[model samples]
Target: MADRGSTELTNPLGALTLDQLRRRTSMKWRRFPPDVLPLWVAEMDVPLAEPVVRALTEAVALGDTGYPSGTRYADALAEFAAGRWGWRIDPDHTAIVPDVMLGVVEMLRLVTGAGDAVVVNPPVYPPFYQFIVHSGRRVVEAPLGEDGRLDPATLAPAFRDATTGGRPAAYLLCSPHNPTGTVHTRDELSAVAELAGRYGVRVIADEIHAPLVLPGAEFVPYLTVPGGENGLALLSASKAWNLAGLKAALAVAGPAAAADLARLPEEVSHGPSHLGIIAHSAALTEGGGWLTGLLSGLDANRLLLAELLAERLPAVRYRPPEGTYLAWLDCRRLGLGDDPAATFLEWGRVALNPGPEFGTGGAGHVRLNLATSPENVAEAVHRMVAALD
Candidate 1:
């Protein structure tokens, strides 16, 4: 059977023209100068799915803009999880929040007190550092293995240090980890659960990118592990469906952690937009076909990126990300010092996320957004090659 593609199966997730994308006021396009090809942010440069557009349009037609309420988002998410990931979700155990990071912070607050240690893996997400700090908690780094994947050897020490001071602690996990796009496996997650349970460190999972797992790769929900019955997971349709501007996410507690989630202040739910809930719920329910198509497109782009890097920027080392639209490029071979993203931005006029900002082993690297068109991807590469010249 000749496999066609997700775009061919459902809707075509278009890669809009430069002029088409620049007119928008979103952060990805708006943050950069007119001459720069902006590819730093996680925002996709594609149009919304038919279901999402319809949901938002219907909301506006009915003048239904108000504060968010009810479990429709949770219900939709439960339905989606069962169909996609084979995980049974209890809608009653889920609650709505403004976004994933905020939900993580609230979850941290639920499990820990001020000055408690929050162990994290880096070259991970940049915000994992900021949000933990903002929560008045201490940040402990457990750098990933040399392969850019979680290692028990590194984690065990971090867990011990975090709990040694007899301070309360939590493990902030980035499943389908950001920047590197390393999707933690079932066995890996089970090992993590065992370690966390052994050390009595609460696990807080940020699974915002759960739905974007590339082809041939599987995304394992941390809470589904053996010892995760007391863990908390933050999920949303924002990343997969490119609905970040909509502002709504869910906090899902494992069987035993529902009480901890319930302790979250009611005021926390007040921040999510009503339209955001409608759109996210619609994405989970009616946007599957579109997501299928988008994934096919991303799978193509991920491979295309590897080929492009190999052809033009041979000095730059890149691994086709296991998940997410972001590409972490190691530019150490270029002798570009600590921050190659800055050099690329200034010389190539192509803005990428500086690696050092991602902490620990992040230097000598740059994160490239790959959720754009193939042509644009090629153009970005051309610019990078020119920068090196």
Candidate 2:
């Protein structure tokens, strides 16, 4: 059952019409043909929070569209952290980046040399493969457990193999991991911290989805564990607040690794959009109530998604995601061949992220974005069933 009380309590996050969204020029709508319903990409279909819009509007009005720099973004994130999560972020130990992946790539350069391995848990966010490979490093796969959780049995060997032959390596971690939407517990993260310390491998955590954790689950910041003092984390308001277009993220350093973070090239700060910093800062500082409302709506949608799937496409096995709006559907049983996304797009005219692109265990799956309205969710399932038929 949907949380009717909670759903009504929050400001509605999505009420999008197909025509209204079609008018936009972003990748989500543009990548597909006019006939296709796009459920691909991490993009959300919601109105901007008033604070974010007001901040960006004020910046434009003041002609403040110059280069971005300063402590305001960091301070806002720090405040958001203290309130949302219990961690105390030091603004001095943070740097602003154009986005999360760029920050991870830069952090990789700081820690690893060319051809050294970078570890990732697959099936993961697809960019983890590209960014690490393009940066002249090999991607070492530490695929998640069949249960869709991180297993130390897999990590222990992967960490050993990754750091073998005196190679400098780093673990590129995805907290509240993408695709699967698994919110890693503190114990799991503590185990990872211990493993990283034992293997002398640096950890770079992409916590972009930190703020989207659904009810009954908790999101643990990677650097908060005991052995995580030397780890680096990337934080952003882009995911929670739907500000990807004009948003930047912060790279935070654990206490022991402050000097290493300072070594990040000063030029990196110049990549942020001037309006991005202002918008992101406003989201963190003044958008708390709006965020609370957004979470409520997303929570309702998660349940609504399950009910629709059960009624329309019961054979499709779906483990309801704990965090993020993305749902990883095990489509192997649907008999639509190895790549289910291709079939869905061709037959149903509903586009989704191809599972194989996420690597390893991703071959028979597709990731569905649930950030749209409940009507879209039901329509997507209807289209999917029609495709399978």
Candidate 3:
């Protein structure tokens, strides 16, 4: 609805004008009008970069839709990782996977077997738990403390207790944590790696949202931390570039962890989409500038949301999001603790991510996507306040 250059609105969530938002809404699913905003999904309404679009177009014109044969896709990804993250991953240690979730499953398969325990920090990505269950491993909960941080004192006890009889095989680490939006500091991850390593557990870092950190905040790649590469880092430009359909993501194996990447079955490797490879290559190599602009836009939206909430919905507590477009709203004070997400859908007419999906600590919260136009954000916040009031 709002163009990239729209002025900052003084009102809370300075969002798009209704008419402008309507035009954008019409381009996608028509289930709702432009006036009825959708902020629930991770996707942004912004258009793709020209290079990404051109790369996919050129690949399709070549007309070779057949299965990808070998490690070319992997090599491209490896190069991208080296240049972008300052992490040196041997193309040999990197695997091109269909999605981050699939990568997680494969990593689980590599290190653990049925009945082994895996730790996850709650109020995290919902799929983290699903992957543990789907893999037939015991889902061990190490929910974050109220400040949205993983508490080592509590976690150490949980790990010891879970492994007292048998060892936990893995830990799902969400760097730049979802829903809560707190980027795991180097010291924080180092503590986790030390604890997990000491207990014979492997760490799987879900870093798909790495590129979306707000200004003045830095995201520490899990593998870069001390003993971090002792684990696996799952990453993709899909989340940062809004290219989920591309189906490309990387599983970077630590020096000690490279064997896990290779141990993945051939069938899994063959399932990667060809277009996904092309789009990913383009996004990583050519999408940096575009991504910078997107992050700038998201930062503006974050400030707008905070300002709006303070003025209108003062009861709602929102910490400044450090990374990712997702904003975590603490709504416990309103007594709408049981289902904040559904309440928003019913009363505010805006679709936002339900906090409960994140895990035990998320019941009184909701996750909002601030990656859209300022106008859309403003309108969504306005409606939410109206509904709450």
Candidate 4:
């Protein structure tokens, strides 16, 4: 394990080599063959923070695996939010859920009915479509602008269309958005709240990537903005701490939305893993130093990726993401067809997420994971450049 101190000099991403990474059986490494370089998923290529490891180890050593109970996770998250973002969270208003996406499904159920519309900004996370549909709701796209920021013009129409016939509607907002990694600003979130209010559309924010906001960018919590009292947000330590296998998240309701959140079924609380709660609570409470170190590493990796792309693959357009560790690359100029990821994998042996899967405006693009060593980022780009030869 690397240094667990809060020093920005600690390089968590550089702590492990490719050989060590491949030995593990996580989805990011095992999804592709040995010859391929996998950068397709959101999983980070780092070891667990010492605090998280110690907490889980102690629990297991004592055979403490059992059902989850109490407000530990919520209280921890409240502390994290208050200290990190200066956003106060009333733990009493938060409910523990299985994970962010499942929490989203439950939040949608509170505000929307069967077959009602749920608006999303596309070229967004692919699962936003899948889970919404699976939850028995219709998807309405308000694709992000060409610059990858939310556009009120687009959102207005989508919100209006979704609420057609006065049907209940919900908007799934991805804060510190995935794939693009564009952090939503306070003004932008306020705009969304205004428009959603006008259209009578409920806002359900998926803020899983909130903790990953890199330097030079600020993350604005949706529920903190004006007119957002009716909104709900899902938060978790899974993304920042890489604890996806340990499933747990919080569904937090705004002041005005507290009653709606109360309607969520009591059985939903049973889904989270008790051990997962322990790990996540420890992460939120005692892992701040480790998180600072990880953020420092990710901050450097994002820039390193930009430098590599600019030097070797200049034709590939990339905008250094303001948040998250995902890079959205435009490969249209590289002549790789609509699904450039397939070509990259077949020829470059570099696995990237096919952009078309992210819905409208995603063609001729690819999403690369940046949560890895700087060496891996350079090598991935090198393989991509070689594919064109």
Candidate 5:
């Protein structure tokens, strides 16, 4: 279902209409009432890539449903990395987990202990705070710069504070960071690797959005940087291919951190579904063309959101994200206190993610999902504008 030319690609976001999407029973569709336009979570509105659907259907038809085995997922990811970003991944250095967040927690456990501090750059994915705290570790914040990029000056102090009293600590980094959609540059990540090295803090990068870097931006795999040889990264095709319902992700370790990753409990590998592995492998290996189309669609949606906000909700400040289908909107000018998402849902009949939950810099903001039709994106803005009246 794609139109391709030498330089043009079909916009996947335009494929489905609002009525078609409403038939979905996923959390993004079901969490709000029928009248509300739900644009809150990370879920995408696109259909599965032909390759992934075919692979899954074949597996089911062949009665291949059993526990996961072999290194197909890792191998496919290695191939995707090499082809997409010119990065190399040693399958021997990877581990499978249920999803990105769980893998982050597991990697944290590998290097840090209970009550130890785990530093994060906020307004980040809210689950980064929850999973860290729930795993018995304390959360530390190093808020991003005013420009929505990582600030080394801010991180240094947080690193020092986290390692106080000789306490072991880990830094949970969201590469191509969430909510804000600021794609961290190679220079920025190299600085982070250098800083983490100086402070003896282990880095666990959540790189789930690595594959979705839109036009005009580059995604640097965390482990590929010079001093990042000691860091661990979590990667998945779930976000780019809309396979969140089929859970699976990879925990890859840098050369220097390989031994540490090997220490993970064998039982941890049991968490991912066999079908999830099959689906993820197929997507990474054969869904490249489909992903290219999705990225094109997302690129268009980001711009459309910018235009809609400029015309209708001029008070809202938004920087089209460099990566991910998520948009972080600064709504403080609308006079909606700390949480504008609540007001939007109640008054606008639209469901967006509450900003306060993202920690630190989240106040007076809201996170909107932009992976839907242009019509929905425009309508969501229209509804939000109506809320203000």
Candidate 6:
């Protein structure tokens, strides 16, 4: 029986012809053999949404290329957030920043002082650590418990302890946490909110990967929860629509947190590119169907990779991710003798994000981006098996 629910873009019926793929390859940076697939970066090889392309072309036609203002982009983002995540954000609460990571830094500056403590969950995004230190704040690592869940029951005490001596002004929460890709549940988020309320610590929830959440996954906006008003949220359509280079992202503040953002220089919202604004707005307003297709493609690729890894690399442990396009593979059992990212580069002729980049809990793992066409994912997996053999 045909798997009607399957939307694997690499399936022969759904894919471009070999000749078409060759043309796409010629357009990419690497001229590797067709068999060698590049899955390192989060970027997808899919074509841009028609709306995005139309928006870019229209902007060029009008010679409207210049510095961007916040009105349109903020409204589009606000509408998208309200429709998709059920969170109502005022356009005023939305600050257009360079990207998700930079948004984190700017928001951190609003809450913490130099040498003040900030809590982070390890086995998480590496940049969280860099952003805290770069802002002159001290990092207090609070590792997530096993079972691949964000259980606030286990984490609240660590956060409380960090604030006992002096308040830990901010907590960096990764919503569909990186590497592990755990979509934090509402119950868990509620506990976190309660904890923050008790300690008077601010929360910064990174929701960059929220739109790519697989079918059946529930995504609750952090600010919608009780006490969510005490924190801010950062998000971008870059991951969902594959527009990372566009430098389009928003930092959403609740009423209580808006004053803190007032400390930023007026220029934070000024220098953004016009094309970025167009692309972002287009994705939010008109790219919904395209995004739905992309999610379908990603779901098929993820299942294929999971099955392939289990059969070919049984020693490597990896539970299926709850959301996002990345797969966290535990390579310690394989004893690849080096970081899996490096090992895969040399042995499999493929590139992957090293586990170390996601913090200590990721030390023995490697993050595989399964966001591309399924054929490419299979090629990379096959190469890995052959290399290990």
TM-score for each model: 0.97, 0.96, 0.90, 0.97, 0.97, 0.90
* Pairs with steric clashes in candidate 6: none
Worst 10 residues of 1 by lDDT: 1-10
Q: For residues 314-384, could you state the per-residue lDDT of candidate 3 as single tens digits?
A: 88999988998889998888788667877777788887888888888888888888877787788888888
lDDT per residue, candidate 6, 1-389, as tens digits? 11112232322212444456456533232545555556665666677777888889998999988888647878877777778777787887778888888888888878877787788888887878888898898877778887777767556766776676775578889998887878888898888898888877889999999887887778888988999986899988888877887877888888888887667677777645668878988888877777777777877877888889888888888877778888888899888754877777777888778888877577778888877677777888888887777
Worst 10 residues of 3 by lDDT: 1-10
lDDT of 5 at 34: 94
Candidate 4 residue lDDT tens string, 234-274 = 99999999999999999999999999989999999999999
RMSD of every candidate to native, in Å, equals 2.8, 3.3, 4.8, 2.2, 2.4, 4.5
lDDT of 6 at 124: 84
Q: List the residue pairs that clash in candidate 5.
A: none
Check candidate 4 and list the clashing pairs.
none
Better of 2 and 3 by TM-score: 2
Residue 7 CA displacement from its true place in model 4, Å: 7.3
- Candidate 2 accuracy as TM-score: 0.96
TM-score of 6: 0.90
Q: Provide the overall lDDT of each model, using Cα atoms, as 2-decimal numbers.
A: 0.90, 0.88, 0.77, 0.91, 0.91, 0.77
Q: Write the per-residue lDDT of candidate 2 for residues 1-389, one digit (tens) a residue.
A: 11112222355555667788889999998998998888889988887877788888888999999988679999988888887788899999999999999999999998999999898999999999999999999998999999899988988888899899978899999999999999999999999999999998999999999988989999899999899999999999999888899859999999998999999999999888879889888888887777777778778878887888888888888988899989999999888877999999999999999999999899989999988887888888988988978
Q: Give the C-alpha miss distance for residue 210 in model 1, angstroms.
A: 0.4
Residue-level error in angstroms, candidate 3, position 374: 0.5
Please list the residue runs of candidate 4 whose C-alpha ends up more than 4 Å from where it truly belongs after superposition: 1-9
